[model samples]
Target: MKAAVVQEDKTVKVAEKAVPKLQPNEILLKTVSVGLNPTDWKHVKNFSRPGDIVGCDFVGKVVEIGSEVPVGEIKEGEVRWGFTRGGVDGERGGFAEYVAVDWDLSSVVPSNVTPQEASSIPIPFLTSVQALYIHLGVPEPPEKVSGEPWILIWSGFTAVGRYAIQLAKLSGFKVATTASEKNWAKLKEYGADVVFDYKDPDVVKKLKEATGDKIEYGFDCISEKGSVQLSQQAFRPEGGRLILLLPTPSESELPRPDVKTSTTLAYMMLGTPIQWGKITLPAQPEDRACFVRWTKITTELFAKGAIKPLDVHVVGDLDKIQEALDMLQSGKHSTKLVLNVS
Candidate 1:
C-alpha cells in the first residue's frame, strides 16, 4: 500500500507501507475520498511526528472486517464515511489508500450523496452538531419555533460553521453569523437570519445590535481572536452557553464572566444526557462512541435532506492532499475541501 507519511523532518511524502491490521471490532476501509482539515497541517507543523498519516474524514468501501465484528457491520462491500481519531499522536489517520476504524467510528455513507459530497460532511458537521446540540445543553425538542431564538455562530462559512447554521435552523433557531463579506450571502442562503462581516471593526456589536441583544446560544467555530471576541459579545446575560471547538487553555482569561462556558474538544460527548461537569478527561473509547452515534444521526438527517453539506471544493485525488492542506492553511478555501482518494 502507498501512504502519505509525515516524516521526521516535518514534511509529507508518499511511501510504500503495509496496510493496517484490524482488531476484533475494526473494519478495513478502501479509501475513496479523504477530507483535509486544519488539524492535518497543524499536526505536521507542531511536531516532527514521524510516520504519521493525517486525514480524518473519509468515504470508503469496506474491503475487510475483523472476525469479531458483528455481522451487521460488514458487507461484501459497503460505502461508508466517518472521522477517524486525528489527534496529533493518535492512530494513523485516513490519508492514505486504506483506514481501519472501530465499527463505532464508521457509518454507512448516505446513498443520496456522492463520495466527494459525503466526505465533506462528517468531521465538521459532526463537530458542529456535537458542539451546539450537546455541549451547550440546547433543547432538542422537535422544531417548534415560538419566534426566532437568536443563536450566533461565529465564523459561519467554514465547514463546521456552515453545518452549525443549518443545524440550528433545523432545530428552529434563528441564526446570526459572522463571516467575510464574500461568504455573507452564502451564509444567508444556509438560513442565517442575519450575517455580519467578521472584518467589520464593530462586528460583534453589529451582530448584537441587529439581533437586539437577545442572543442565547453561541458556537465559536473559529478559536482565534475574531471568534473568541465575537462570541463573548454575542452570548446572552444569564443561562447563555458558549462552546469552543478548541479547548480553553487553563491559563486563558475568559472575556465573559457571567456566561457559562465549556470547551467542545471532547466532541463526541455533545448532545447526550451526560453533564459536561461530570465528564472525565482523556475520554475512554466508550465515551467517544457517544459522538459516533451523534454523527450517524446527523448523517441520516443529511441524507433525508434535513441538513446539507455546504459548498465542497473537490481538489482531485490523494496525491493532491498536500495542496488541499495548503489551501486550508492559507485560509483561501471558503468551503470544505474534499479529495477523491482513488
Candidate 2:
C-alpha cells in the first residue's frame, strides 16, 4: 500500500506502507477517493508525528468486514464513506490505498452519489450535524420548530456553513448567513434567507437588524479572522448559543458576555478520545449516536435528491495528494478537492 505520510520536516510524502489489520468492529476499505480539508494541512504543520498518515475524509469500497460487525450491517463491495482523525495514526488515516474504519463511523453511499461527491461530505457535513443538533440545539430535520426562528451561519460559503444552512432550513428555521458578495446567490440557493457580505464593516449590524435582533443561534464555520467576534455580536442582547468549529477564544476576545459558547470537533464523531499536544478531548458517545442516526437520514435524503454535495474538483490520484494539499493551504479554491486513490 502507498499512503501520504508526514515527514520530520512537516511535509507529506507518498510512501510504501503495509495494509492495516482490521479490529473486530471495523471494516477494511480499498480506498477509492478522498477529500482534502484544512485539518489535513494543519495537522501536518502543527500536530502530526513523523510517519503518520495525513488525510481525513474518504469514500471507499468495503473489501472485508470484521467478525464482530453485525450480519447484514455492512457487506463486502458496498461503497462507504466517512471521516477519521487523520495524522494521528500511521496506519489508520484515509490517504492510503487501504483503510480500516469502524463500521459505525462510516455510512453507505447513496446510489446516486459519486465517490468523489461522497468523499466531500463526511467531515464538513457531520460537523454541521453536530453543530446544529448537538450543540446549537436546532431541531433535526423532519422535526421542525414553530415560529421559524432565525439562525445565523457565519461564512456561508464554507463547506460546513453550506450544510448548516441547508439543514437549518430543513428544520424550519429562517437562515441568515455571511459570505463574500460573490457567494451570496449560491448561499441563497442553499437555503439562506438572507446573505450578507462578511467583508463589510457593518455586516453584524445588518444581520442583527435583518433578523429583527432575534438571531439567537449561530454556527461559526470559520472561527478565526474576527469571525467569532462578529458571530457573537450578531446574537440578540439576551444572547444565545454559538457553536465554533475550532477552539473557543479567550473570554476577553468574545464581545458578548451573555452568549454561551461551545466548540465542536467532527473527529469526536468517531466516539473516541482525541489527544493533540496538551489538549485532550474526551469521547462523547452521544455525539457518535447523533452521527450514526443522522448519517442514515442524510443518506436517504441524498438518495432522494433532497440533499446535495458541495462542488467537487477531483485533482487526480494518490500521487496528486500533495498538490491538492497545497491548493487547500493557499485558500484559492472554493470547490472541495478530491483525489482518486484506487
Candidate 3:
C-alpha cells in the first residue's frame, strides 16, 4: 500500500506501507476520494509521528467488512464515506490506498452523492452539527420547521458555515448569515433568510438590526481575528450562545459578556477529549451518540435531496494530496477540495 506520511521535518511524502489490519467491527476501505481541510495543514506543521498517515475525511469502496458488521446495512465492495481523523501521531488517516475505520463511523454513500462530493461531507458538516446540537443545544432537525426562530452563522459561505446554515434551517431556526460580498446569494440558496457582508464595518449592527437582535445562536466557522467579537454582538441583548471552531482569542479579542460561549472541536468525535495547550478537557459522551444519530439522518437527507453537498473541485490523484493541502492553506479555493486517491 502507498500512503502519504509526515517526515521528520514536517513535510508530506508518499511512502510505501502495509495495509491496516481490521478489528472485528472495522471496515477496510480502498480509498477513492479524500477531502482536504485547513486542519490537514495544521497537523502537517505540528508533525508528531514521523511516518503516520496524514489526512482525514474520505469516500471509499469497502474492500471487506468485519464479521461483526450489521448484516444488511453494509457489505463488501460498497461505497462509504464518513468521519474519521487521520495524519497525526500513529493514527492512520484516509490519505492512503487503504485505511480501516470502525463500521459505526461510516455510512454507504448514496447514489446522488459522488465519491468526490461525499468525501467533503464528513468533517465540516459534522462540525456544524456538533456545534449546533451538541455544543449549543439546538433542537434536532425536523422535517418541517414551524416557526421562524432565527440564528446567525458568521462566515456562512465557508464549508462549515454553509453546513451550519443548512442544518440550522432544517433544525427549525430561521437562518441569517454574514459572508463576503460574492457569497451572499449562495448562502441564501442554502436557506439563509438574510445575508450580510462580513467585510462591512457595520456588519454586526446591520445583522442585529435585520434580525431585531433576537438571534440567539451563532457559529463562527472562520475564527479569525474579530470574527467571534463581531458575531457575538449580533445576538440579542438578553444573551445568546456562540460556538467557536477554535478557542476564543486573547482577552483583547474577546466577545461581549452577554454572549455565552463554547467551542466545538470536531476531534472530540474520537470519544476522548483532546489535550489542547494547557487544557485537559474531559471526553464528550454526546459526540459518538450524536454522530450515530446524525449519520443516519444526514445520509437519509442526502438520499432524499433535503440537503446537498458543496461543489467539489477534484485535484487529481494521490500524489497531488500536497497540492490540494497547499490550495486550502493558501485560502484560494472557494469550493471544497477533493483528491481522487487512485
Candidate 4:
C-alpha cells in the first residue's frame, strides 16, 4: 500500500507501507477518495512524527468486516465514509490504498451522493453536530425548537460554519454568520439569515443590532484571529454559551466573563482519547453516542435533500496530496478539495 506519510522536516511524501490489520470492531476499506483540511497541514507542522500518515477525511468501500460488527449493520462492498485523526499513525490516516476504520464511527454513504462528495462530509458535518446539539444545546433536527432563536457562526464560509448554518436553520433557528463580502450570498444560500463582513470594524455591532441582542449561542469555526472576541461580543448582555473548534481561550483573554466556552474535538467521536502535544483529551462515550445517533439522522437528511454536501474540487490522486495540502494552507480554496485514491 502507498500512503502520504509525514517527513521529519514537516513535509508529506508518498511512501509504501503495509496494510493495516483489522480489529474486531473495525472494518477494512479499499480507499476511494480523501478530502483535504487545514488540520492535515497543521498536524504535519505541529504534531506529526516522521512516519505518520497525513490525511483525515475519506470515503471507501468495505472490503472486509470485523467479527464483532453486527450482522447487516455493514456489509462487504458497501460504501462508507468517515474521518480519523490524521498524522498520528503510519497506517491509520485516509491518504492510503487501504484503511481500517471503526465500524461505529463510519456511516453508509447516501445513494444520491458521489464518493467525492461523501468524503467531504464526516469531519465538518459531525463537528457542527457536536457544536450545535451537544454543547450549544440547540435542538437537533426533527425536534421542534420553540422560538426563532438566533445563533452566530463565525467564519461562515468555512466547511464547519456552512454545515452549522444549515443545521441551525433546520432546527428552526435564525442564523447569523461572519464572512468576507464575497461569500455573503453563498452563506445566505446555506441558510444564514444575515451575513456580516468579518473584516468590518463594526461587525459585532451590526450583528447585535440585526439580532436585537438576542444572539444567545455561537460557534467559532476559526477560533483565532480575533474571531472568538467578536463572537463573544455578539451575544446578548445576559450572555450565552459559545462553542469553539480549537482550544478555548483562558478567562483573562476572553472579553466577557458571562459567556461560557467549550471546545469541540471531532476526533473524540472515535471513542478514544486524543493526545496532541501535552494535552490528552479523554474519551467521552456520551459524545460518541451523540455522534452515532446523528450519523443516522444526517443520512436521512441527505436522502431527503434537507442537507447538502459542500461543493468539491477534485485535485487528482494520492500523488497530488502535497499540492492539495499547499492549496489548503494558502487559504485560497472555497470549495472542498478531494483526491481520488482508488
The global C-alpha lDDT for each of the candidates, from Candidate 1 onward, is 0.74, 0.90, 0.83, 0.90
Q: Write the per-residue lDDT of candidate 2 for residues 123-154, one digit (tens) a residue.
A: 89999889988887767777887899889899
- Pull out the clashing pairs in model 3: 53-87, 54-87, 86-93
* Model 4: per-residue Cα lDDT over 1-342, one tens digit each: 999999878889899999989999999999999988888999999889999998889999999999999988998999988888889897678889899988888888889999999988989999999888888776677884778888899999999998888999998889999999999999889899999999999999999999999988889999998899889999999999899999998998999989898899888887889897898889989789988887688788987889999999999999998899999999989999999999
Q: For candidate 3, give the lDDT of residue 97.
A: 88
107-221 per-residue lDDT for model 1 (tens digits): 7777788888888876787777667656765555354445778888888888889988988998888888988888777888889999988888888778778888888888888
Q: Residue 45 of candidate 2: its Cα lDDT?
A: 90
Model 4 — which ten-residue stretch has the worst lDDT?
136-145
Per-prediction TM-score to the true structure, in the order listed: 0.89, 0.98, 0.95, 0.98
State the lDDT of candidate 3 residue by residue for 178-197, as single tens digits.
Answer: 88878888888999999988
TM-score-superior candidate, 1 or 3: 3
For candidate 1, the TM-score is: 0.89
Using TM-score as the measure, name the better of candidate 3 and candidate 4: 4
The residue-level lDDT of candidate 3 at 77 comes to 87
The runs of at least 3 residues in candidate 1 whose Cα sits more than 4 Å from the true structure, single-residue gaps closed, are 87-91, 140-147, 249-252, 266-280, 284-289
What's the count of clashing pairs in each model shown?
A: 3, 0, 3, 0
Q: Give the clash count for model 1.
A: 3
